[model samples]
Target: MSIRHCYLQALALSTLLLFSGLSLALEKPIGPAVLRISGLVTQPNMLQQAVFDMQMLQALPQHSFTTQTPWYPEPVKFTGPLLRHVLAAAGSAGENITAIALNDYRTEIPFSDALKYELIVAILMNGQPMPVREKGPLFLVYPFDSQAELQAATFYNRSAWQLRALQIK
Candidate 1:
């Protein structure tokens, strides 16, 4: 073949290969149990503990507390991992995290509260897994009974239930 034709053919092949690799690298993976909401998971960092599936949250050492809230008639028993642990897992270090629930309910939580309190992303209630109707899968809960300061209207509004995504900002 002519040298010019060969050179052009090689250049086109290289361009195709480079573009193909880029596309493959950007493709996301899907699994039965785990969901990749956004970004990529690198080495297990401080924030690895921050993100959890329903099963993973249940498997971890459970923390339970009875708390009274306007939503319920009686004090409720909440069970889940401390919010800080989850934030640590996600390697999050921000002033606020915008939480989005399954039903698209969204709220922003201050990082200070997560660091100071035993706020948790709860998957179970009263020893039973919560369903969507019952606010299941995940719920951002604060130890309202432990600290009267957390029982205010503002904190109650930030407690997002059936949480699906948390974007740090």
Candidate 2:
């Protein structure tokens, strides 16, 4: 990709996030709502939470990476929209985020991690949608193999699978 293309993409994203932060009204989910993001956000579809379905998540720009993770037997390709973009769409402002999994597991992650790393809310694993048994509808993943720092347990713990909700603070 050319520098000009990158510049244009950045410009478009900046304008979208900045101008729509306050006025973005999320539409009712067309499919089953899969994720809820609440707390410290400028825009919320519900009282304090913004719910999203698969279609909503897929609407954002998608990114993918193949990485070796502790849970997987081999390097697997994961794909989803960048976590930062999702937060930006929600008009989120926070120092931290609490990820809640389907089984009630939760973990705290610094907000800076999203900006600092190419973290993704993975909806696909190995180019296919993951089943709940395999860590499903959503997974907060870090590109562990991309950087030595990401290989640590701190980052691994942040890679919450079967993710259901996020509370930003």
Candidate 3:
């Protein structure tokens, strides 16, 4: 067999394996999907959308930070996976994200925010699970205390609560 033939065969096998792995990486949610990410995603598990159960989100690297918000009387500790990590799991490659809450309130968050700060999709506040009435099962919590500029109204608006879905743009 020629060396050229061997090289071509190896390349073909690697390409096939890569594509197979990508499909296998997407798993259906076992429990009710708490979060749904659609549009501009490479990996979609449920009806061509990326859906996550609470356990799935908890499996990712955890990030915690304390920050004061207008919604709360005092500084609260927020804990969950970083937004960028969640986006990566969805295979999202977009410039913007339209975060929609359960109440239908929506906000546009630049993708750069995820990259620039340790913005968390918070599942816990002050070491306790937050129910829907408390602004979660999920909340997009910015590290407001980390940067002075993040304390502004624009950033506050971006900190969406009761987050249900994200539409990548």
lDDT of 2 by residue, 33-73 (tens): 89999986666877788888999998878999999999978
Model 1 C-alpha lDDT per residue in residues 1-169, reported as the tens digit of each score: 4568545534443454354332212122222222113232222322332334555444445678889977789888998877655544443455577878888898988766776788888877887888878886677888888987887999999998878877665
Q: Give me candidate 3's TM-score against the actual structure.
A: 0.85
Scored by TM-score, the top model is 2
TM-score of each: 0.70, 0.86, 0.85
Evaluated against the true structure, the overall lDDT of model 3 is 0.84
- Candidate 3 residue-wise lDDT, 1-169, digit = tens: 4568545534443454355342326577898989999986767888779999998888877889999998988999999988877777777656688999999999999877876888999999999999999999999989999999999999999989999999987
Q: Which ten residues in a row have the lowest lDDT in candidate 2?
A: 5-14
Predicted model with the maximum lDDT: 2
Per-candidate local distance difference test: 0.63, 0.84, 0.84
Give the 10-residue window scoring lowest on summed lDDT in candidate 3.
15-24
Residue pairs in candidate 2 whose N, alpha carbon or C atoms collide under 3 angstroms: none
Error of 2 at 91 (Å): 0.5
